[model samples]
Target: MTGTQPFVLAEQALLGALLLEPSRIDSVRPHLRPHHMYRPAHAALYRALLDRPPDPGLTMADRTMALVRDAGAHAAGITPVYAHTLMAACPRPRHALVYARMIVEAADHRLVREHAVRLGQVAAADHARDGLADTLTHHRHLHRVLDDLHRRRPDHDTATSTPAVPTPELNPEPPLPGNLDDEQALIGALILDPAPMSALSRWLTPADFADTAHATLYRCVHALVLRGEPVDSLTLAWEAQHQGAFAAGDGGLTPELVAHIATSGMPADVDYRARRVLRAYVLRTAASAAAAVGTHAGDPTLSTSRLVTAARTALTPLDDALARRHNAITATKAPFTHTPPTTTATPWCTGVATWPTTGPDPTNPTAAHGPRSGRRP
Candidate 1:
């Protein structure tokens, strides 16, 4: 069959199964498990649909696949395979196998062909599973023993083109001068943009990210924060509105260590937007945890889901308010304080960026809400 054909067929097959009983997902689970003859992208799309606002006419299976496509998921068959592989890496690979099988069987040869490329691309030494022969298999296991390995590998720094090291006394290049709100508006974009779209997109949105400066700042902070480095103390030779704590020498955590802790199972691309969103989420999550700690003495509140819920509840109102204000200013091209600077000495330092800070922000109208959160702001 053709490429789209298998998607339709697989979608229909799952829909039929779902019609009998939404809870009967496992009944068809056998067809999707790992090592199955024909592996489809673990009908991950279908399973992902279970967690959304109700949509009529379509069964959970159809909606799940639809969501996948909307997010630019390609190679209907490969989708299942990737899902399976991901699950294999999960603490429990069983569910990944089931979902993968369903999508595979539903797909046709065309999907299989295209998807083969991706499977090969990611199936490198690092992603492959390892264990039996060598106690530490797979890159993940190797990572568990990274410090030991680094100690053994010959030190051959490629001094010709090496990235600069961040230090404690560093003062990052100053960002373009701008008013607090506009700079923050830029920060708001950075803090909210999701680096990768997945099932989790339905849960929350970051509240504060604004622009590229925020994005850079966020990446620097996240890279440092994940390493357990102090955000409030570090100093770096970088400058961006989100760079406050990061430049301070407290990149919160180191990059390698941070990657290990952010188990969201997706990468936070070091892009201006993605990093910004990550920074906001990480910071706010930390803030919430801190707040929870403080309030624990007063009342027992701010459970993970509740705090996340509160953020979700406030997202719409906050976004709408920001949009109206931004549009009104732009409609007249009003002389605003947040406008970017016209000249720059270097792309990284002066090209209309914001220098991050931890001080009081008057424009932080919805500081109460974070996109990934579920509590009330």
Candidate 2:
């Protein structure tokens, strides 16, 4: 016996009930479809049952034999021996609806799991291509399937205590081999020219970096740019030191390495390189979300509603990244720079020019101009 044997028995019982009382097929038909059968042979038998209804003139034994013979035309391996086994398994044919409901619940669980597996496959493919559009399309399809399952679920569906979902047998396949290299390149490009940080910052975050050290350095660069401070190797190294990026235990980033990273990439490609890093983050997050959905779907103990809810929760991170990407793409321009409150002169300003509190007013030409000289506005 295997983990699936219980469902197999349930399938057998449902079939047995319908076999004993062919009239009950009408009652079960609304709730149980042929595809709901876990075994292909059983599904073939179901279709046979529907197609070769007992001739009113035939004896029950004759009808059973005829249906069993007919099912062989649709699927291989159907035999009279199994037909006898199914008939003997029926406890009471009158309760056929109950058995049908049982079969439907188990079948729905299997369907949900199969759908999750497909979604995971799509996400894995997207990861291979370093893209998210196809993954998002499949993600949406999975949700639609889940929603339809929720509506189809019998009202009596009771919540079972969710059994623990087994973790992936192996750690998620290590991230794409090129992810760290892309992170390094994006960081290097941004350090070489901070101008693109204005747009990149709107959608990209330090946490998106796949490498811990790269993330730290990106954060340093992001901060310097946000403050309107000049971003150079020296300024970044100083910020990194204060952030403890070069602590003894941390070996990935050193002062000399920071200088190298600052000059390692072409500044002109900063925006394009930054998008690559962001794409990697999205792909990784989508793959993780797909895995979580699969895990939840596999837990037979979870009700359809619970499974759907769990899947949505697992997908939240990917959804967030998608939303950010949409915002970045749709915005006409980056929002105005927001400098933190400081009593001292603005770090990037030459003298006592105070940063403006609001964005430029299109109607006021002067609103776009800062203090003209070394005087406060």
Q: What tens digits encode model 1's per-residue C-alpha lDDT throughout 130-195?
A: 111121122123222223323432333454533432111212222223222333433233234222
Per-residue lDDT tens digits of candidate 2, residues 229-344?
55678788987886778984354789998888877865556656666777777777777777777777777766666666677777777788878767766643555443332325
Indicate the TM-score of model 1. 0.16
Residue 244 in candidate 2, Cα distance off native in Å:
3.0
Deviation of model 1 at 259, angstroms:
62
- Show the lowest summed lDDT stretch of 10 residues, model 2: 345-354
Backbone steric clashes in candidate 1, count: 66
- Per TM-score, the best of the predicted structures is 2
User: What residue runs in model 2 are displaced by over 4 Å at the alpha carbon?
Assistant: 1-4, 52-56, 129-133, 154-173, 248-251, 331-377
What TM-score does each of the candidates earn?
A: 0.16, 0.78
Q: Pick the candidate with the highest lDDT.
A: 2
Candidate 2 TM-score to native: 0.78
Candidate 1 stretches greater than 4 Å from native: 1-4, 29-45, 49-102, 105-377
